[model samples]
Target chain A: MFDSKQFEKDAAEIMARYDQKKAATLPLLHLVQEKIGYIPPEGEQWVSEKVGVAIVHIREVVSFYTMFRTKAIGKHHIQVCTNLPCVLRGAEQVMAYLKERLGIDAGQTTPDGKFTLSSVECLCACEIAPMCQVNDRYIGPLDRAAVDKLLQDCV
Target chain B: MASEMVLSKRLKNPGGAWFDAYVADGGYAAAKKVLTAMTPAQVIDEINKANLRGLGGAGFPTGKKWSFIPKDSPKPKYLVVNADEGEPGTFKDRYLLERDPHALIEGMLIAAYSIGCHKAYVYIRGEYIEPYRRFVRAIEEARKKGWIGEAVQGKWDWEVTVHRGAGAYICGEETALLSSLEGGKGFPRLKPPFPAISGLFASPTIVNNVETLCCVPPIIRNGAEWFAKIGTPKQGGTRLFSLSGHVEKPGLYEAPVSVTLRQLIEQQGGGVRGGKKLKAVVPGGISAKILTAAEIDVAMDFDSLTAAGTMAGSAGVIVMDESTCMVKALLTAAKFFAHESCGQCSPCREGPGRLYKIIQRVAAGQGRRQDLDVLLAVAGNMEGKTICVFADAAAWPIQSYIRKFRSEFEHHVETGTCELGHAYAHH
Candidate 1:
């Protein structure tokens, strides 16, 4: 499954930075996710072999973290901060708006596979409360208009 | 009184994150002074005299933490900067990383020199992509200026690598941070082999908070007595208090340790939002016990808040106004703990999840009369029984919210709905 020589070379560089091979699990998984958009079963097997760890252990690490997705996701991942601070500042209303806009509930992807909505705990951006992360960008203090504009821009 | 702004002095400056701007504002002068003139013991002594405590929730003294490193150990010592500011309602470290990245870099250099560490890793949270990029840029700038790479300043050898955390709140715990740094799950390790002795990569490591390290540069530049005199005698120096939720001006405020909660809410935070009456305050992060409206007159320092039955944990001041429902609030807090628990221990794993369910039921207007006592009992069992204080932190909001707002909880049970409606339950 691991055919790319460049991918193997990059994985080796990540392993060389750490003292133990087990320590390269997260970085390697992140690299795979970055390269392939999501961790497929083949990617997991690739990581298990690359890190020289058990496949089950690699799966456990992958499943434990929220960022690592086992399945394929939509083109855009919309993570709304629904933790306490955001909740106090009307995160629910924001989530409701996103649900209506996307025609999907939390943790569900749109039928078109355009956007996946998930409520997350504190993105540590409480200064601009009621915030959400659309892919790598942290956009905040969202209202109906802002979320609409965000959705429009996502396309 | 005007709040002192030592760490946040450059917050409002345009282009403050840039290396040249930071240098123009006297950024690495302290670092150069420490490396060129001061000994490791002298640097530690100055910080100890300043009485600066850890700003990452715990109030442990900074210099004493650095001193814990075994001087005679053969292993390459490590200094890990805990930039994983995951505590809810706390956002000060984000400001430090974004606005004043050079300050933290300078502080990291001083800390590395003090602990005899050649290589340091800044384990920043993955979510903080902007701050992470800003920090990495600052490090590169410093490298070009001959401040950070390979025999830093032509006298001592020091290098810094910025590592990103996947997504785990428990990694804010020092040992758990080390575990995550080694590319594993964020699980708290057993003590007696604390980070100072057996930390990242099985070496004597010192994990200091980003804000705690930022304070080091100032303490080295100015005399320790100057930093000591800024705050109370014991706590020493100003701190970044992140004020959010129900306040008119909800943002980060750098204040002295002697600043009262009332002053923070009214003076700094511009009072409650929409002219509403204050209902309650989580004086620190969610881990510290909630404070009633009547109790917010107390000082916000570590010792003062502790004496007032709360703590100065992370200084995350979360204010709630009169329209907020206590039961729903507790439910929100419970859900956070439930989700963030590393789950290595049974109590933390099961306790928060169960507590969250009970609170969820109670908030959804399906509560039993005995449920209140059950909440307290579950919280009691969870405290002090886990590998780390995560369970204890989870239990605190349960115990304190119930104790302080018993009537609000009773109202939820009797009315079969929240006083503030089910707005919080939409998620």
Candidate 2:
């Protein structure tokens, strides 16, 4: 089911950026995950072949970085920052609100598979404290009203 | 009071990153001047005269770091920009990367020319999607304008590649960054075969901070004397302090290094939020020792803070008012260190986890009397043992918080609850 022929074209471009082909391991894995939504065993083997590292080594790389996922997440992944700054600005309340509304704790996906909630460290957006990253965008200074709107907007 | 805005001058007016607008503001002039008129040694000397230190927490001298690269090393040299800015209370690099990325490119060109590095790599954090896009766009514009790529300004040859870090705070360390750049885990390698000697595939490498490089263009345009005059004698130019937490106005403010912490909290941050009395302040990032309200009169420079028994780390002044709880704050910080430790050394790998567990017990109203002593003893052992300074950084919050606010921890342990009211409930 995996598209090896199509993936190679993009994989070659990423490998071309680095002097050593092994340096493209992360980027190639990222590309595979971006297209497939998670790093499956096949995707890992493909990346291992492309970057010239063993599949076990590629799995080690995948497990080390927190961003790469082994399993697929929900349609919308929400990562709430519980670092000191956000905690000072009431990130706990935001997390609690999401938990109550969605009926799931941190690192859990919704039954409908519409949302995934995670509690993460600093995203380096402290100026907008009490913030969360939904997919790619950062929504911050979160309050009760904002949470209501965010859940609605997830659709 | 507004000091000389050296790094943030262009950020004042919006849309400053447009290629034509950046060119109109005399951008890339420094790169042109360095490539055409100045020798590599001259460029290094000029930076030395400027007295600029790295803005990414360590405060190491920039020119001295660049000078470490061997000119006669047959292997190609590399210039790696550390844009993996993930200090808990810091977010200034995101602004520079998004608002005026041309400054960083120009800085890189001059830096590459000075060190004879034909290739440069920028390691940006993956969470910073917007900042990364804006920076990549700026690089594309420069490539079209002949500021980057095979022939920079049609004089020297330089190429820049932007590498995105997956998600690890440890990658902010230079050695760890090189490891991640080489497509491995972000474990920091032992130094002495320092990056300047053997780095990025066994070649000489120079790793500079995002803000440190951004300061280079101004130092090149105006003479080193002019740049050095903007701040204290030891540290040149202004710093974009990332002011956040319990402040009425939590935002980035550019001020001279000579500026005291009080001025940043009062004048720039509009004092503590809701006119509450100031309590304790983390003068730098979470790792720096916390400063009480009385101790904030000291200058916010590297040396001054060092004399005051703290560090001017990352220039992230996190203001805390009287309402803030010290025990809760320490727990949050400890949690960060525990979560981000790369598990390389035995001390750093084990120490932060233990600290967080003990603190968690205290915060949840089940702490024993010997918890404080155990915490201090554990923290003391963690320092000076790790390959990197991460364990020491982790130990600081545990040491400083309990030392400065000993009574608070004692009250929590003895009474099994916070005396200052629940931190999360009211918030």
lDDT for residue B289 in candidate 1, whole number 0-100: 97
What would the per-residue lDDT of candidate 2 be over residues B1-427, giving only the tens digit for each residue? 3447787778877688778888899988898999888999999999999999999989999999999999788999999999999888999999999999999999999999999999999999988989999999999999888888776656788888888999999999999999999999999999989999999998999999999999999899988998899878899988899998999999899999999999999999999999999999998898999999999899998999999999999999888889888989998899989999999999899999999999988988889999999999999999999888889999998999999999999999999989888743311
Candidate 1 residue pairs in backbone clash: B57-B314
- lDDT measured at residue B150 in model 1 versus the true structure, 0 to 100: 83
- On lDDT, the candidate that comes out on top is 2
The TM-scores of all predictions, comma-separated, are 0.97, 0.98
DockQ, all candidates in order: 0.74, 0.66
- Candidate 1: Cα lDDT at B218: 86
Could you give candidate 1's per-residue lDDT for residues B263-361 as a string of tens digits?
999999999999999999999988889999999889887899999999999999999999988888888899999999999999898999999998888
Which residue pairs overlap in candidate 2's backbone?
Answer: none
TM-score of 2: 0.98
- What is the C-alpha lDDT profile of model 2 across A98-133, one tens digit per residue? 999999999999999999999999998888888999
